[model samples]
Target: MHGVVLAVLLQATMAGGKHDYNAAFKSADESGKPLLILVGTNWCPGCVTMKRSVMPSLLRKGKLSEVAYAEVDADSQSGLAGKLMQGGSIPQLILYRKTSTGWRRKLLIGAQSEMTVTTLVDRAVEQQAALQAESAEQSVVTASHVEAAE
Candidate 1:
């Protein structure tokens, strides 16, 4: 019984909760990962489905662990929602990559099946890895050029 209770508690704690847009962006920037922002209202059925069904499956598969996940309530946090949306619809899933200028939106739109969401997340991770590698190469080249100049 004690073991069972401990397992349940651990699961509950590991499961993520709702987050704001800025917090999500900041986390992604700090971690060098992408941001997944779910924008919707409490009253939206699709939003509830996304939170309960799709997100959990992705989490179980460790798809979202590499990125920051956030939820913005459309009705309650209208201002933040609007800014994140930029005049988009509710139940929107926006994926942003951290860049020098800021977090640049990569993908924007609805919740998908577990497979689809996983695939999208995987693709984003691959893209981020490539970008980081490219940046590292450029930095090395720049350093070599500076050494030659000196």
Candidate 2:
């Protein structure tokens, strides 16, 4: 609970950034925003480079200003981090969108440019919106069918 609150505050502090798994997941689910999780180890040179260069560059460019971003240390947050590492990649970017079944994820491995992240995020948002619209349409059709049956 405290973590969630802190995470919310963290988001507010850093323009939609959260380092806590629960915080990121909950916010993403609740707000219908795609969650971008960065998984890597602290000692990893790639991770350090990404942290020092790629992320900050994107942030400066305002590419990630509205993003629900989360950074996870693989060694510390094994539970959330392990699942993303199934493909055997470090400095992985995992984008998650909440769906009817659960969260659907898309992965981008290694360090990436701001343009790459921007393009991927744009597509993810569009895809999620389309899925949701389809689901809503199905729900309405199902309701109409049930009404017709009565």
Candidate 3:
């Protein structure tokens, strides 16, 4: 049963895959992966540039081949923007990573090269792995305490 679940999850994190903001967050939680979010509005040229050129180029060059990505419209998702940011900026790449305490964010404002995005995503994934390991260790400790009490 665990093997089947692992296999399915392994298939899900093929990298460079684009999902919606909600899906990206869910995927990160489920697969223990990090999210690469491109925050923008429909009218923002920089956002369009990253979407139509930079990101697509990165995808074509296999730069983002190991991370999950999402393009979010900050203007439309005002509630999300208010919660996540002080300034709603376009073409901002935000990496949302899960930690033992909560979510950690790495923000890159404005347009970035393929390498910049790649490096950030890689770092976020590494951090998330550490967080997950810590959480697993805590769970083990908690379970042992419960067993000892019983």
Candidate 4:
């Protein structure tokens, strides 16, 4: 009973951006959805542009409907921001995709245009689908080989 309540609370808190980052990651993992993280600071002009304009536009277009998205303020979530960032640029976008073997990570630094973000998400989703198909095909082939041996 308590466990179920806690899980419900966690899911409720992870609806979109400006929520608990850890909760968002857990939700994405449990749902098998790709997690999209935007790391930025409030004072940065580029970061402001992304947070205010670019992301909203993508959301409106439904490009992000399939993703679990989170926004991390670099100033407040410095520890998490540091771990996700590869460069010193603000507004770093990170995508975590669950594959057959493990989680795949992709990153884009600096403020990006809507087209760039769309391309990254679309490409990642497409690649994940291809991987799933390949994995399924391998399983079928392995089963056939085992049956033939038997």
Task: State model 1's lDDT.
Answer: 0.77
Backbone-clash count (model 3): 0
As a TM-score, model 4 comes out at: 0.77
Per-residue lDDT tens digits for candidate 1, residues 14-39, read: 44344556677788878899888888
Descending-TM-score candidate ranking: 1, 4, 2, 3
RMSD of each: 6.2, 6.6, 11.0, 7.1
lDDT of 3 by residue, 114-143 (tens): 788778877776777677688899999999
Write down the lDDT of every candidate, Cα atoms only.
Answer: 0.77, 0.78, 0.75, 0.85
Most lDDT-accurate candidate? 4
**Stretches of candidate 2 exceeding 4 Å from the true structure:** 1-18, 138-150
Stretches of candidate 4 off by over 4 Å are 1-20
lDDT accuracy of residue 14 in candidate 2: 69
Candidates in order, TM-scores: namely 0.78, 0.70, 0.69, 0.77
Q: Between candidates 2 and 4, which one is better according to lDDT?
A: 4
Candidate 1 segments exceeding 4 Å error: 1-18, 86-88, 100-102
lDDT of 2 at 38: 81
Where does the lowest 10-residue lDDT sum fall in candidate 2?
12-21
Error of 1 at 55 (Å): 0.7
Task: Write the residue-wise lDDT of candidate 4 on 52-126 in tens digits.
Answer: 999989988999877778888888779889998887787899999999789889998888999999999888778
